[model samples]
Target: MSMDPKILAFDVFGTVVDWHGSIAAEAKRLSLPVDPNEFAAAWRNGYKPAMAKVRSGTLPWTKIDDLHRMILDDILKTFNITSLSESQIHELNLVWHRLNPWLDTVEGLTKLKSKFTIVTLSNGNLGLLADMAKNAGLPWDLILSAEVFRHYKPDPETYLGVAEIFNVLPEQVMLVAAHKDDLLSANACGLQTAFIERPLEFGPNFSRQDLHREEFTTYHAKDLMDLAAQLNCK
Candidate 1:
């Protein structure tokens, strides 16, 4: 790497938190009729297409909370789950706000914070990220989101927005994410990129075959702790 990043922008959902496991646990706790794992997978599967609609102007700028509710309603019908009341459904949609962090998340972020300005770069809205940060005890210097940029990940605006906010060159910001496409997009925008491996991001039923190191990334780490070590953060 030519220059060490001053800002470490994180991709939140799967990279920092265990979304699949958290959702599945919540569903099981609620005693939903559908298989919890399958239910969680179905909900997450809708995320990209929902965002794509916004990107293509098929839907107006809708925050992730609304998008999540929309997906939840559709999946409920698909699973034939009609027992939950309106209040129950609404509360369930807020699972994103209550997601549990990966075991290494808080520690890693704390360590990294001592070295760089740590902030979120998630598609999740500000409120959602804030609530999650509070709930998970995540130590973030800032919570930036697609809602703030009005553009989702893989979009140049969202990646470059980080640099613009901090008044720095794109290469001075490193995007750390679990998804390859996200890192590739950041790399294309002249930002440093780091890939965080999350083999069980989708749940135990599914296997991610692309967890290996990729040429596009400046660093490829096993998890946030590993990333902290690689960055020499104590």
Candidate 2:
């Protein structure tokens, strides 16, 4: 909070979209013979490890779309699902492109837009984020991704890249995310932080007892609307 950042970089996936609900609905729509909730959880469970490989330089930099597909292939085998045609599988893989925004997202972003510049800093590819923004009506001034930096979140490059994009000091860029580690990484690079409480990011049945603000984040809010209100957005 040292400087008023003109650009607000958002963490997508759980921060902006209901990925759990969206994946579950897609699973149901495909008539996959697995519990939608379990399938959704299983799919998400692979995300961190997938990115870890890239972070550790064990795997080349890849977009979240490819990472999701790799996980999907593994999950399909794990669940003994072999009935899906190639086209069906490919179409299903695009669920990320059609994720649903949280109920307050569009309205909150619209309000915030009047005061500040907004952009995504997601691990998802630009095409993926663009499609999701369009499909979900997210009002972003720009769409940035790991594809641009070739590094995933928690990487200093990705955090600082947002600042570089707007030709501002890192302290002049704020990262808004639901995950602490992400905000911490941004903070380490001299960026301000805002923690968003996305209780059901994983799934509704899962317990998210830790929703309190941490010392690392500059601001914490119940959702985007609350954040906008705190920032005095009109």
Q: Weakest 10 consecutive residues, lDDT, candidate 2?
A: 1-10
Q: TM-scores for all candidates?
A: 0.99, 0.97
Once fitted onto the true fold, the runs of candidate 2 whose alpha carbons sit more than 4 angstroms away are none
Clashing pairs in 2: none
lDDT (Cα, tens digit) per residue for candidate 2, span 1-234: 455678899999899899999999999988999999999999999999999999999999888889999999999999999999989888889998999999989998898888999999999999999999999999899999988998988889998998888999888889999888889889899899999999999887998877898988889999999999988899
Best by lDDT: 1
* lDDT score for candidate 2 against the true structure: 0.91
Tens-digit per-residue lDDT, 12-109, candidate 1: 99999999999999999999998999999999999999999999999999999999999999999999999999999999999999999999899999
- Highest TM-score: which candidate? 1
Error of 1 at 170 (Å): 0.2
Q: How high is the lDDT of residue 42 in model 1?
A: 97
